[model samples]
Target chain A: MVVNMINRVREQRPLIHHITNAVVMNFTANGLLAFGGSPIMANAKQEVADVTRLSQGLLLNIGTLHEDQVEAMILAGKAANEIGIPLVLDPVGAPATRYRSDACQRILQEVKPTVIKGNAGELAHLVNQDVETKGVDSTGEADHEAIVRLVAEKYQTGVVCTGEKDVGCMEDEVFVNETGHPYLAQITGSGCLLGSLLTASLTVEGNPEDHLMATLSHYGRAAEEAAAHPDVEGPGTFIPRFIDALAMEVET
Target chain B: MVVNMINRVREQRPLIHHITNAVVMNFTANGLLAFGGSPIMANAKQEVADVTRLSQGLLLNIGTLHEDQVEAMILAGKAANEIGIPLVLDPVGAPATRYRSDACQRILQEVKPTVIKGNAGELAHLVNQDVETKGVDSTGEADHEAIVRLVAEKYQTGVVCTGEKDVGCMEDEVFVNETGHPYLAQITGSGCLLGSLLTASLTVEGNPEDHLMATLSHYGRAAEEAAAHPDVEGPGTFIPRFIDALAMEVET
Candidate 1:
């Protein structure tokens, strides 16, 4: 099933619209291309609606949130909803500041996100649960299963809480994926790039839960392969190898 | 001189405040770290003045310019000037959009940029010289020498016009650096990353012309080394290797 889903993504080559943060734009764009998804990064208010309307999927991340981009995210999210395409939300840095927390909540209340993905801290903060978050990194531990289920049920959307062990919950059903490496934490935008992969995978017509699981597994496996490369001495060398591994089609 | 300049950067560990676009923030930050400089990316207008005041240098890039960020750029640029630190301006995509062009001009008029960097087309647009630029990429040829000299003399700032051959002009003297690879253009934010490196290098107490030349040379040399790696098949794999190469402190 995962193999078929992966193949479908490459076959369809869906265009994914992104209103993400500046920090991970290039990495996310390249990751989408590696995973066989076309990426259009248009965040300006004047054209986000048009761009989102033309895409097969939309991703909203609030890593570097500002007042104008928050408005653009709402505009793009509504447009994506109007077109009835899948939408993914990664509430990056939600626990760090009130502005970020408020913005994420606003986007959540306004747009019906098909999938909500973030670290334990971000997801926990979304539902009024406390978790230690420093800047954009999730520092404290939380019950991933409970948070995933709570967010999934509250928003009626698939929830992916990522860390050493990734838990994907859709409604009451939960899927656990243990396939990533610790080296991923050393690099910036590793979590943000996963949101991009999920956005692309959602373009495939399949079970939303399975799509999220497949993406998590694929990304984790790629990181493992990249970390194990002989030349990947540290995080710096692990990045490009990870990208190359993402481009490689692995069979289940 | 170049070796000392680079060593000074590592020894000083200058904190660079970046009001740059989202597309290359991760790469830019990672590249700055790799090159032995500290990077702080803060764009919120609420705290940009404080951030700029604390940093050794400032980088103002308009690749993903919006109304609020334009204000933050001006705010940060003015703060950098008040502190008497080196400030670099990269007019990314100036020729592509009216907003970008206007913002670049506004910043130039208000802040005395220490070094102004861009491609032939972007520099030409800043000086009212006609050159073809498609989006952010320079599509037509212009006299690099004339544009560099004109902009350098007009703004009384050092000018660096990057292309097949990079021309750095400071007043009557012009230095051409032919040290980059075609593969540098294959990756997004390569130019923006250069700006980050330049921002860090400018923090060194030296001739602005040598600092810009050293930055371009180091970046180009790293790209060449990254492209020559046997494991680098394409742009996907080139990124990590480039970061690793940048981390390798080679002799001048």
Candidate 2:
């Protein structure tokens, strides 16, 4: 299933329009390109509507929220909705500042996204739920799962909370994939890159949950492989190999 | 001299304030961190003046220029000028767009930068020079040298033109360092990252010419080493190793 999905992504080369923050643009662009998807980062309100109309999927990330950027994201998100292309929202750094929190809530309220992804901290802002116990997991992990479940239910969209264990929740179906590296946290924008990968995967043929699981497992496995490489001395050395692994997976 | 400059930078950990483009922000930050300099990217016009006042140097790159960011650059540049913190201007992609060209010109007129850096194509816009031959070098190479020299003379600031060979000119001094690989061109923001390295180097106790040449040499050498690694399959793998090389050079 993963190989078929990879082949479809490479064959289709779907365009993923990004209205994201400053910090992760290049990494996200390169990662998408390496993974057999095209990325267009047009955030100007004047052009985003037209640009988003031409894309297959749209990704909105508020990693570095600004009033001007939020305005552009609204324009782009509306265009995506009108055109029926899938829209993915990653509310990065949400609720850290009043501006960030307001921007995320406004975006969620205004735009109808197909999938929502972020870390537990960022999604906690979206879920706003007090958690009870879930199985044998610790409170921390259980809290994350509950948050993901609530956000998925509330938004009527797939929710993914990424950490040591990547948890995906959609329509009473919960999936956990534990195949990542500690080095991921050391680097900036790893979550933002996941948003890119997820948005790209969404454009391919299949159910949203299937694409989401494939992206989650593939990204995790790549990080694991990259971390095991002999020359990956630290985060500095791991990023390139991780990128290479993302590409290598598609081919092999 | 290179070792001493690197040592000074590590000891000082000079804060470099960037009012640059969005795409390269993460890479520039990581590269500077790897090179042992602190980076602060704050492009809010409301806050740039205060931010620049606290920084040891300022780097302005027009890779992704917007009217709002241009305003912040002017504010930050003025603040850097006031505090006597060195400011380095990289006219990235000038003349490619009307907005970028205008932004570069406006910044040059408003800010007295300590050094001006770009490639031959970009410096051509700044110099506005008609070239003649120098020695037996190709007209292409000679044209580049003429552009670098004229810009240095016109700005009365150190100038660097980067390409296959990196050329630096200040007053009557012209230095060339030829130790880069094809892989450097394959990656995004390598030039913007150069602006970061040059800005960090400028804050140390050294002549502008000396620091410029050292940054050119060290950056090129790092690229060469990263490209030569057996694990580096392509540009995807080249970036992480290149970053590791930047950090490794400072330590070992």
All candidates' TM-scores? 0.65, 0.64
Candidate 2 per-residue lDDT over residues A1-252, each given as its tens digit: 788887788888787888887777898877877777877666556556766876889999887777888998998899899998889999876746677778888887889898898777777767664333222112344467888887888888989888789899866788888988888878888888889889888888777788888898889888898899897889988887888788764644
Cα distance off (Å), candidate 1, residue A40: 4.3
Instruction: Show model 1 residue runs off by greater than 4 Å.
Output: A22-26, A38-55, A64-69, A82-84, A96-98, A129-132, A140-150, A186-188, A203-206, A230-240, B1-17, B21-27, B33-58, B62-68, B77-240, B248-252
**Over the full model, what C-alpha lDDT does candidate 2 score relative to the true structure?**
0.80
Worst 10 residues of 2 chain A by lDDT: A130-139
Model 1 chain A: worst 10 consecutive residues (lDDT sum):
A93-102
TM-score of chain B of each: 0.97, 0.93
Best-performing candidate as measured by DockQ? 1
